[model samples]
Target: MATTKKYTAILLLLVILGCQKQDTVDNFPIMGNLPMGEYQVGFQTLFTYDLTKNAIPYSDWDGNLYQSPTSENGRQYQINIWYPAQPDSGTRLKYADYINLMGRQTNFGESEEQKTFARQTFITQTRNLKNIRDTENKEELNTEQLNQLLDLDIFARLDAQPAEGQYPVVIYPNGSSPAYQSITCEFLASHGYVTVAFAPKGRFSSGMEISTTGLEVAVDDLEFVLGKVSEKSNADMNQVSILANAISSSVGAAAVSRNEKFKAFISLEGGFISAFEQRLLNGSSFYKPENIQTPILFIYSPHPSIDPKYTSHLKYADRYYAHFPKISEFAMLNYGMFDEFIPDIIGAHSGNTKKGFETANELILRFLNQTIKGESGELFDDSFMSSRNQIDTTFVLPSLPKPPNMAVLKDTFWKEGFDAIETIYQQLKSEGNPQPFSMNFYTEYRDWLAWKKDEDYVYRSRLYDLAYDSYPKSARINYYAGYFSMKREMNEKAKRFYRQALSLCESDEDLSASEKSTLRTYASEDLNSLLK
Candidate 1:
């Protein structure tokens, strides 16, 4: 009887220990659903300096002046990359791992005290407890729950071997916070994209400024990061996209407008913020909505006050605006509700929020697959989005009254001839549009007319007339007019144009040495031929 009792007690103890272990595993703090991909995710943090630009003295998150042991010679960047990796290649990273990286920021080799201070500051800011209490779940959680949140598995491994084959690249510019969108970066990596993000500092400080100069700085940093990521063997630079959040969306829009290398743009609860739209997007010359030819996906919270005029500006790109009803902007980028505090620091906890998060991930993946990867998916179809009650998406094709540029004018000329150019120019001028043709456009059109003069003399002469009338100060335009007039056997008119060309070539300081010499020679020859 003693032996039987001893064995039963031992068995009961074993069962209790097993249950405790299981409970610990279950209590690891859920981060919503696991990454739904075949390849494991790999993460890496790279610290490099852009030698072309100078660094500026900046402050930390706690508003303290950042003093590094070594003086920075150039602009510092802390680039975070997450990519598809070989399964089981490296150890999985904890949420704390990312927080630690966030602490390093521009100072990768700081003292222990500084590192700890930065790390704690990052935790405090990322937690955003006040916002959570006010906007999210108000329930006060126990200390254990908050501690468990840091130990959550974030689904990305550190320094894992990259998977075989090239992957599309998605660049996320987080402004000053390198690890702001950690979950989103890892999610894209798991879905077969090499995601890259960097901490973009301001021109005079470490923190990002809200001015136009600040926006330009962000765009420049993005371009530098693009060059660095292109060096990766597994990165398909040809199929790259920009995935931006909040104010960074304006930066992305500006960057996409300048660089044709980007294949698509994804904005997460961004792009239509009133201040950003007016100051960053509309105010900056770099943010040309008409130049954006790639498709755009805008996932935003439904705000009735949002102006539809912003969407109409994107006349050249296919736009899809997805409105998540009753969902906060923070919830779209994060996962799981109240149970997960670290990932959803400022996020709401509700069934609807969870559904919105999942649907957003699906929508993003499908949109990328269709737009960037050239896969024929149902992202644009109504039925595909109809299945999700949490999301209401509307597809807007390129609209009418396309913004006028050199390319538009050229296309109009090609289809309907020079008469269409005159009509459009007059119409645009009558509408109070100043400077119908840019100086570059005038130069390009003049050169184009010169190249195609022999193909159709009648059409060429008409184009030359338009060019000379628009830019009479251009010596090259006058030379071309004289040549075309000579071709039409109008010797007297040709002589008059040639004389004018020679006078401008001699006096026009704007004309280059080579241009003036060529124009003078051609004009003199045409005038002599007219005399003969």
Candidate 2:
């Protein structure tokens, strides 16, 4: 992303180095599982050394970093399985062990220095927050904070056998970056499900394989793993699910949309973007969504890599539902709060904080229990859409009304306002008569200009005018215009905008719960100020 040639060159070199992976097996963590669930967790690493039968030919895959082109042993993947351990199971494991296993199990092992830095960095931050400043308590606090961060009891036993005849299964896949294994694996296992994930370190490539033939390879690898899962004595094959993180959301969404194999697909910050959304920059389409009938639930937060001022995660879910109409559940997690939950960790994919982590697990548990297990009433009901009767806005995305097609703009101004900008862009791109729509819109709007929806409104009155006309019904936009107008001393105009925003918010279905709450709160304040 750097503009300088030297830095850009260096980044490119790092990309190749990043691809080098360790041939060693995965060393899964042994922490006492996360505590929200009833059963204590017991975890073990697994490997399916081969998948030759009914397998895609070795020659078919473009790259095989692990083996020869025509490997006799077929593709192998290391799996991490967490399950209910018996109350009398072995002593709880140490967090240091968890960190060490993770260090070596990665595609390439981290340098001893890199691993040490990570450990010390985490410990120091934890020590400060917990106020464990006493020098002597270093050892004690290290252990305590580690467990606190992960919600595990290193000394506890796993409830190996569930009261039910067999434990249901959950297959979790990492995102494109394949950075960290989600703590959800342990949380689910602790609650009586046989939760499985590809190892935090070793078996990451399959999950990373979505470029061209990567998706097919991932599916093949998954099929092989699931087939082998039937061999796990404690696992129940009848009820199974898949949870995907970020970019992997595409894979899960695609799979669920195409078939009936998975009972539920839980997306953490990613969805079927490939199906309807196109990245205008490179003119690339990632993956197409399937129109299958499987139930799917989404939990979305802004991508850590994106600047929040520019992007609102509120629309990602809307885009997906707009394309595939059948999706039953969607949540737009508030941005700033999620960042607070995982201050030390970055990215929407981590999902590793006290509040952020728990909310995700609880919803997932309720959804799985209700939909797959045939239980009911555990989840919040119709009120999920009520802006007033919502849970702590910190944890829930506020919902607002959305009619199929309506806007705040008067019909007379709608067509003319947007066409003005379109004509400007047209001239700018015209070979014979190119002209600037002003230097700001020309240079600042690169790939972003391709999508009219992401354009700025507050500063660019034309954009705001165009947007209000284009999506006059959007509570978020109306609220922005009101706030912008109020700040700029357009008292009468601001008053109208504020009043309109308040009204539109009640009927604007596109605004997520958080968006609606934000608009309503600000508009009320401005409207109050105007009257005074």
Candidate 3:
């Protein structure tokens, strides 16, 4: 009897070992259709947009939208969706920065910066590379060369999921900017629509590539892409919309004009303004905005009047309002103070841009949700004046903010805190029984800093409790504790301890993805080991 019992235990242990080995191979995560999250689809990887092969000009005719002379080329563009991948897929996506838009050829970012450096380095010896003829090519790289100079990558987020059933589709043609497609695509996706960022024909195969020969060509491309999506089993044929930005705005309008299937049209900083007008305030392709059978949504920056290049788009809005009496929704948003690009600052300031981008995106989501799903309420009132009036005030914010300066401060904080933790880590490597407090302390400090900038109570509370339990030695333990205590409505305790904790805590973690992944790996390994 004793021998049998001992053998049974050994057999059971062997079986457990076998199961552990199996788990590693079964790493592909089983994802259920939960509330939408980021997902990178395989179809997005099939092709790429190569702007280098078909260079399109990006010159801002003064602040007006610049059309590449090569815009007349046949459609052959590429776009990649940067979305949330299903967790446990064991796949890491390789993101192509803006340089990828121009095929795999040149590094536009470096070339642009070098242009200035070259000017400074040689002064008169060499004009900017733009003027210098290529010795090997024996020709001045004109429109196509300059067109490839400015490119941005497209990243699809998990938020880009289409709602169940055949839903309407929207094609967001990026104007003046490459990354804008993801922003608009994600926004429409959140509202249960199948949105595609069409890489213009000049770009990679993954994205929609349309000719810039005014609105008619854009409309044709929209129709072409929609037809392609409609062929898919998941696409809904009944309802559809097209949203465009900058130059694409005309494209969206033109598309709806010819295709009755398009239920609505939205223009972000877009209008019937003709690209051909000597000045920016030209009339759009649609003469009577009210006659536009489709409902239109216009999202504009509130202070375009101050922006030299965007100033003319404001007049287009006036023309739109004059023509389309009661059938439009307008959202004019203040992007924020940091977006101020004063001279030398150029594109450096983004606080306002981000704020506006997010707001515009959310508004687009709400608009699509109500219009496509046929959800009715005061929210759908098209006659509502001003963009701010149409916002959905009920939805809670989804993510926490990592402030603009967070990146700059990361090294400093990590040196002070992470270095100390590394020391403890090394000691543990030698079999020292160090408490698992460092990870917790780092998480709390990072979250607290996030809370300070964005005031997200949930993130702040979770981090605080984690720190309190994991690293009591942490200098800011009390701050986190006090924060949550008050957040949980523990007013007295919060008031009593917040000041004390805040005073003691040093700088916090920036909460980089690498750090989070490390923590996750450790936890997962431990959980697996314990199960054994």
Return the TM-score for each candidate structure: 0.69, 0.46, 0.41
**Candidate order by lDDT, highest to lowest?**
1, 2, 3
List the pairs of residues colliding in candidate 1. none
| Candidate 2's TM-score | 0.46
Local distance difference test values of all predictions, in order: 0.70, 0.48, 0.41
- Candidate 3 lands at a TM-score of 0.41
User: For residues 133-172, could you state the per-residue lDDT of candidate 1 as single tens digits?
Assistant: 3655544434565456556677777899999999999998
Deviation from native of the Cα of residue 109 in model 3, angstroms: 20
Which model scores highest in lDDT?
1
RMSD of 2: 21.9
In model 1, where is the ten-residue run with the lowest total lDDT?
21-30
Top model number, TM-score: 1
Candidate 3's residue-wise lDDT over 492-513, tens digit each?
A: 6665455444333333342335
